[model samples]
Target: MSDVGDCLFCKIIAGEIPSKKVYEDDSTYAFADIQPKAKVHVLIVPKRHYATVAELAQNDPAELSHIVGVAKSIADDAFHGAYRLVFNTGEDAGQSVFHVHAHVLTGEVLAE
Candidate 1:
């Protein structure tokens, strides 16, 4: 697998940084967010070194879909209810990590 030298998500997926993994496959890796916005917040990251979803979508559309698929399945199984899939494209959009990832957020308010 290719890795960006300073990418935090890469480090996490590489097992150098500790993370609570929710799901993992050849193409994607899902783990709990350290700074969660909701009670159940997980980050689904692509193993490849795409800086943003737009990049992933343009270069590897199938991998992008796989990330979303994993996000859907993990969110459904973990929350057993509705969840939000969020992609922050840039720093202004609240993307602290540059690695391409989708955030799965399930909230009590969503169920209400």
Candidate 2:
């Protein structure tokens, strides 16, 4: 898979950085977000690095689908089949990590 230089998520995927991996496949990786916003917060990413969803959309349709599909599986298996999926595309949207990722959120933490 293609990785970006100095990308945090990329390092996590490559085993250079440790992460609490929840799920992984050839095209995607899922893990707990270090800074979580909900009780069950997981971040799902495409194996190939993309700074934003827009970038990912331009590169591979199947990659995008794989990321979302894995996120769905995470919720279905761990979060009782209910969760919110979020994507922060740019600086204005609070996207700290440049690589594109989908956040899976569930439980009362978000209700507060």
Candidate 2 on 1-112: residue-level lDDT in tens? 2347788888999999999999888888889999888888999989887889988988897898877778777778776678888999888888989999999997543563
Reference-based lDDT, residue 85, model 2:
88
Worst lDDT 10-window in candidate 1: 103-112
lDDT of 1 by residue, 4-66 (tens): 898888899999999999898888888998888888899999888898889999999999888
The TM-score, computed over Cα atoms with residue i paired to residue i, of candidate 2 is 0.89
lDDT of 1 at 51: 88
Q: Candidate 1, residue 12: CA error in Å?
A: 0.7
Clash pairs, candidate 2, are none
TM-score of each: 0.90, 0.89
In terms of lDDT, which candidate is strongest?
Answer: 1
Clashing pairs in 1: none
